[model samples]
Target: MGIGQSGSKFAISDLGFVSGGSKRRDLGLNQLILAEIGPIKGDIRRPVSCALIRLLQDPDVAVRLASCRSLCFLIGDCNVSEEDFNEFLPTCWSACFRLMEELQEFDSKVQILNLISVSMEHAGEKIVPFAKHLTDFFQKMWEESTGESLLQIQLLAALRNFVGSLGYQSPICYDMVLPILQKGIDINNPDELNLLEDSVLLWEATLAHAPSLVPQLLDFFPYLVAIMERSFDHLQVAISIIEDYIIFAGAEFLNRHASSLAKLLDGIIGNVSDKGLLSTLPIIDVLVQVLKF
Candidate 1:
C-alpha cells in the first residue's frame, strides 16, 4: 500500500520504499526506517507487522536485527496501545525466537535479548499470560548456552526486566536463575567480574520483587556474607539484601548464619573508612537489634 493510504498525511514512501526491495542492504535499512517512524499508521499496523515478521527472519543478520529493533521502537514509544500491539505479539515473539535459535553470534543474541527485554517491559500486564512460557524459555536458554558468558550476561540483564515486570510472579524464573546467580556472584571466580554487577542487581531485584522466596533463594542468602568479606564495593546492595532477608527470611535466617555474620561485621567495623562506617552502621544496628548481640 502507498503512504497516502488511509488519509495519512506523512510521506513515508522513502522510508517504506525499501520494504519491497530485494537486496539485503535495502531490507536492513528499510527495517530501520520503519523503526525510526514507530508505527506507520494505526490502520496499517497488522500488515506492517506481517511484513516485519517475514523480514525478521531474513537471511541477512542485519535485516533480522533491524526488524527486531523496529519492534523494540514500536513497543517502547507507545505509538500503539498495549491492547492494539497485543495482536502482533505472538508472531513477533515467534520470529524473535526463531532468530534467537538460529543465530550463532553472541552479539546478535545480545540484540534479540534486548528485543525480548524491551517487549516484556512495554507489554506490561499483557505479558502475564506468557509468564510460564517465558520462564521456560529462559531456563532452556540458560541450559543450552552453557559456557557462553557473554550471552549469559545479556540474559541476566534481560531477566531483570522480566522479573521486574512479573513482580510477584517473578520467582517462577528463579529455578533457572539461582544457579547462574550463584556463579555470577562468586568472588573466587576470576571470570565473574563481568557478571558480578548485573548478578548482584538481579539478586537485589529478585529479593525486592519476588513475592515469596523460593527454597533456592533462601539458600542463596548466605553468599552475601562472603561478598561483604571480599569487597566494600557491593556493600550498599549487600545491605539492602540483608534487610530483605531479615524481613522475608526473618529470625530463622539470622539464627542460622549468625556466627559468620558476626565475624563479617567485626571485619567491616575495623577496616572501613568513616563514611563507609556510617553506611555500615544501620545494617549492623539492625542485626544487633534482631540478634541481641
Candidate 2:
C-alpha cells in the first residue's frame, strides 16, 4: 500500500495527466491505474475517489465503462472496515448514478448495471441506504427505454436484482414495479414476443419478491385476459400470473374483483374448444380453486 500520507493527493494530481490524452487506450490505461491504486480508508481516499467519479462521466464510452469496472474492482479490493465502507458508499453510488444517467449505449448500460450488482454483492447491507436512489434511477431508465428489447431485458434483469438485493420490504418493492409491468402490458405487441416474454419474466420475478403486489394484478386483468384470447402463449403467461396472484394474495383478493375475474375466466373457458383443453385446463383449475374461496 504505497498509498502514503500524500499518496491520494498524488493520485488526484496524476489524474490530470490521464485527462490529457483523448484516445481510448489512454483512458483505459488511466482506469488500470485506478484499479491498481484501489480505494483506501480514511480522508486520504476522498480525492482519489472524486477523480474516479469524474472519470465515470468521460465522453468516451470505453473510458466510462472501464471506469465503472474499475470502481467495482476498487470497492471489492479495498480492505476497509464496515464504518469506512459506509463512508465510501456515497461516492461509489453517486458515480454509479452518474454513469447510469449519462451512458446511452445498451452494452454500456448493461455493464453499469453489472457494476452495481457487484457493488451490492460486496457491500451487502451497506447497499441498503442507496436503494431508493437506485430504484428511482432504474424507473427512469425503464420509462425512457423505447422498444429496445435487449435493453428492456437487461433493465428487467437489473430491476430484479435491485428488488432482490433490497428485499421485499424495500419501499421500491411493489409500488414502483407495478407501473412498469403495466406499461409493458400496455405496449405489448404480439409480434414482439421477446419483449412480452421479458415483461412476463420481470413481472414473475417482481411478484416473487413482493407477493402482496398480487392485488395490483387486478388492474391489468382485462388487458391480460384480452391477450389470453388472442394466443395460447399469451394465455399461458396471463393465467400463470393469475395463478401466482391467487397463491400469494389468496382467493379473497380475487373475490373482491369477482365479477371481472369471472368474466375473464369465462372468456378463457369459452375459448378452450378452439384453443384446446390441454392448454387451458390448468387455468381452469386455478380459477375453480379461486372461486371456491
Candidate 3:
C-alpha cells in the first residue's frame, strides 16, 4: 500500500529508497498528501519528523527543496507542538546549515531560509539558543559575498527574522549582529529597498531590546547622516534609527553628540527645497523630540 493510503504502515527507512530514484516524484506527492491529511499525531509524529529530516539531506536538490516545504507544512501548518519539534531540532538545524554550505543553487538556499523563517515563527524564542550558530553561518556568508547579491539580500531578510525572533537579550546581539548591519548600510543601492528596510527594522529591534547598544551605534552616526541624503526611503529609515537612538540613549549621549548632529542637520535642512520640507516634516518632528531630551 502507498504511504498516504489509509491504514498503510510504512517504515521510515523506506523513505530513503523512495527519495532516491525516479520514484522521488512519488515521494514528493506522498509528502504533500500527508501534509494535507492534517497533523501526524501520536505514535507517528517522531518517525515522520526524523524521516523528513533525512530527506532534507537528499542528494537530489529537488527532493531537498520539497523536504523543506514539507517540513514547514508539518511544523507550522500542522501546529506541531514545540516539544515535538525540539526532539528533532538539532538534526534539522544541522541539515539546514549543511545545505546552506553545500548547495550552490540560490533557490535551494532560499528554500532553506523559508523553512527557517517558518520554524522561528512557530518555535518563538525557543529558537534563540541557535542564534549564535546562525550568526556564524551568516557572518561567513557575508564575508564571502559582495553583500549586494540577491542571495545576500535574502539572507539579510532571514537574519532580520532571526534577530526579531530572539529579541535583544540574545547572546549573539552586539558583536555578532553589528558587523552585519554595518555591511547592510554599505549597500547603497536605491533599488535594493527591501534589504535596507529589513536592516533598519533589525536595527530598531536591536535598540528596543538592548538600549545599551546606542553608544555603539554612535560610531555610525555619520553613515546614518549620509543615508539621509539618499532617496526618500533611505532617508526615512535613517531618521527612524536616529529617533530610536535618541530615545534609547537618553539625553547624556545626545548631549555629547548634539553639536555634530546639529551641524549635520543644519547642512541637511539648508539643502532641502520647499517640496522636500513637506516630506521631511516627520523627520523634523523626531529631531525636535531628540532636542528636547
lDDT of each: 0.73, 0.63, 0.66
Worst 10 residues of 3 by lDDT: 12-21
For 1-293, candidate 2 gives per-residue lDDT tens digits of 44433534444334443345445444644555565754455764444444456666676656767777666655666653445445666776677777677767778888787777666655665567787777777777777876777787777776666766666554454567777667666545642565666677666656666636544665665666555656656666666677667666666656666676677777766666665556656766876776686
Candidate numbers, best lDDT first, in rank order:
1, 3, 2
Pairs in steric clash, model 3? none
What lDDT does candidate 1 reach at residue 29? 42
Regions of model 3 farther than 4 Å from truth: 1-30, 33-48, 59-61, 171-173, 187-195, 259-293
Ranking according to TM-score, highest score first? 1, 3, 2
Candidate 1, residues 1-293, lDDT tens digits: the string is 43335554444343343356455444644545564643356655554555566677678777888788776665665365666667666777777777788878887787788878988887766778888778778887888877777787888898888888888877666677677788888877665877788899999988898776667787876677778777888878887887777767667777776676677778778888888778877776776677663
Candidate 2 to native Cα RMSD, angstroms: 7.6
lDDT, candidate 2, equals 0.63
**Best-fitting candidate, measured by lDDT?**
1
Comparison by TM-score, 1 against 3, better one: 1
Model 2 earns a TM-score of 0.60
Q: Per-residue lDDT tens digits of candidate 3, residues 1-293?
A: 43434665644444443334344644644464455754466655665666677777777766767778788778876667777787677678778887777777777778888887777766767777777776777777767656447877777777776766776654355677787776556556553454666676666666666626545676766656556556445554555566666666657656667776676566556776776556556656766786774
